[model samples]
Target: MTAALNIYDPSAKPTAGPRSLAGLTRPQMLEAMKSAGVEDRKAKMRAEQVWRWVHHHGVTDFEAMTNIAKDQRGSLAKAFTLARPEIVERLVSVDGTRKYLIRLAPGVECETVYIPDVGKSGALCVSSQVGCTLNCTFCHTGTQKLVRNLTAQEIAAQVIIARDDLEEWPTSAENRKITNIVFMGMGEPLYNLDAVSDSIDIMSDGDGMAIGRRRMTVSTSGVVPKIQELGTRTRAMLAISLHATNDDLRDVLVPLNKKYPIAELMDAIRAYPGLNNSNRVTFEYVMLKGVNDSPAEARALVQLLKGVPSKINLIPFNPWPGSPYECSDWETIETFAEIVNRAGYASPIRTPRGRDIFAACGQLKSESERLRASARKG
Candidate 1:
């Protein structure tokens, strides 16, 4: 008879510290259970129970997993941890938008924003990385250098934290404040694909967060190679940060366009899997004054997106300190929208949300640097 190995031996010094089980997918969680000395036959069942508790019930404490055996729960506590990123600061805008400065680890922070009344339901903007690699000229986050990619657990924790704040527990549809999630925060998501994909899977799990795949959109700044891969892996709604209509201007606006120009980006968009009229791709156009918001540019945009099912999201430029561009005048924006609207595409001017809190589009920068600066002053 083989004796079971004690995974949580009190006197034994652990080789590695406890692993966080928060953001793990079902398969990954099963593997973790097997690693923790759970029998192969029971690992899947055990992982399902734990997954329901951690994600569905939003229980952080192993002791609260009532269905799990006490001995196993104790073992899980020793072998794993369920934690969300620490909320260093949470600011609520007058418009009911909430921005969280979440500290992933010491000195590593990211911003998550909750915007109310998107499609009559609230939406949470989640970050995939601590900072961004793309130096999109107008973006505040681009000014900050890349720190590191957030793990799947860190990404999923943003949703968990927001749900906790909203008091939308038990995962009921009626009380759901955050029905949609947009990966449009600090970092470029395609750069951190695996973690983002896994995190989305966790968020969209029917038994847990229960957010539909269609309600979750992953916005990319045209990472060409990863576009099709993202479609295959996540199958979530796609949004492009398409600020410019032409390559020359786009090369300056979004530097990634230098490598993957408008033509290549359009090609990738055309090839995206599961794209149809109902699941149209979104082209986010920030209306920069005297930049990319002309009637000719709008006509050019319609021409470029020809035969592609898409919607144009005209965002008024949200200014940050030292930003060179200004938002287009309301009349100019309306005219630009008219061209796209006349072309049979929906072109809605996105109202700036969380602007007071600096949580609007292109305004997410970590507070860690500011906090460090203050510490140095003292």
Candidate 2:
């Protein structure tokens, strides 16, 4: 018999110390303040004031929170920190895609990406784990060993750090460019569900960044167990990293399929909370040269996703060093997309962005560890 799983309770009280503002949700902050004896109405007023300054105004210093009493600011600063992850390196692609290597405290790091397109809707890809544990065969991120799960502070900092570089204020909705957030950058988002949930809540809260729940997406590579809870808690759009069709091939492509299998994974996906035509799931299929790019495979994909309300994102394989797969020929990819389109599913062939700087899809590797390795040898 299998042992019971130990899931961390997110609602537990935070320990007293230097807590980062990036980590706390609006409610969590309120709770923290109350725990620290800010339970009365005046205390609640102080909590709201601090929340607005930290999130709405994007104040990096507690002292700059002018609305709060001067004495309270000093006390808050002594107890908490409005800290952001330091950018160790920032690279911008010719296509306006920007990738940042952010350092989280000592010996911790992650990458975040911003993709600029024709529309005002740009996507910010955020990382969940410091390194990936899934180790999907075709992904470059899977090459590195799993370091650790990013804290809620680390996860939230990715958004704050991006907004800082983009000069984005929550108030400026008219010229605001970043319209979407995707947990598609580095590790498996499901593995770090607590942090991902907490971070995204801050992103979607109306009083702060104000991104709609529908605009946020959490991508998982068949972490079946967490799918239902994720749908219930966040209710953001769900995206599954479903690169292959059959269990036999999927086991090799995405090794997690070996444990969960397609049948079990599909069962969980079908039962996902808030699933309907209005809130459809996305199936991301990366087309490899002659491997999974055949018209037959496309038909199989349509059949597999029969009852689900979904859009198949037909992605051409983005190659990296030592990658075994090559992108499918344009004609092959087109043929494959035609089969799915005819099957009444929207199969948009995703355009590869930031390939020049390797910031495109499936090409993110943490420069944090690479730089450290180089420094040690020197």
Candidate 1 segments whose C-alpha is farther than 4 A from its true place: 1-17, 371-378
What is the C-alpha local distance difference test score of candidate 1? 0.87
Instruction: List model 2 lDDT by residue over 1-378, tens digit each.
Output: 221122334564335547776556777787767766665776667777777776666788877888777887787777777877689889999889999999875676788999986235798999988778888988888987777777665677788888888887653457777888999988888877877888888888777777788889999998888898888889989999999899999998999898889998899899998889988899999988878888889889999999999998988888987899999999999999999999899999999988887888888888866667569989
Which pairs clash in model 1? Answer: none
The TM-score, computed over Cα atoms with residue i paired to residue i, of candidate 2 is: 0.91
- Structural similarity to truth (TM-score) of each candidate: 0.92, 0.91
lDDT at residue 109 of model 2 (Cα atoms): 79
Candidate 1, number of clashes: 0
**Candidate 2: C-alpha lDDT:** 0.82
**Tens digit of per-residue lDDT, candidate 1, span 36-98:** 999999999999999888888888799999998999999999989887768999999999999
* Candidate 1 lDDT score at position 86: 82
Best by lDDT: 1
**Minimal lDDT window, size 10, model 2:** 1-10
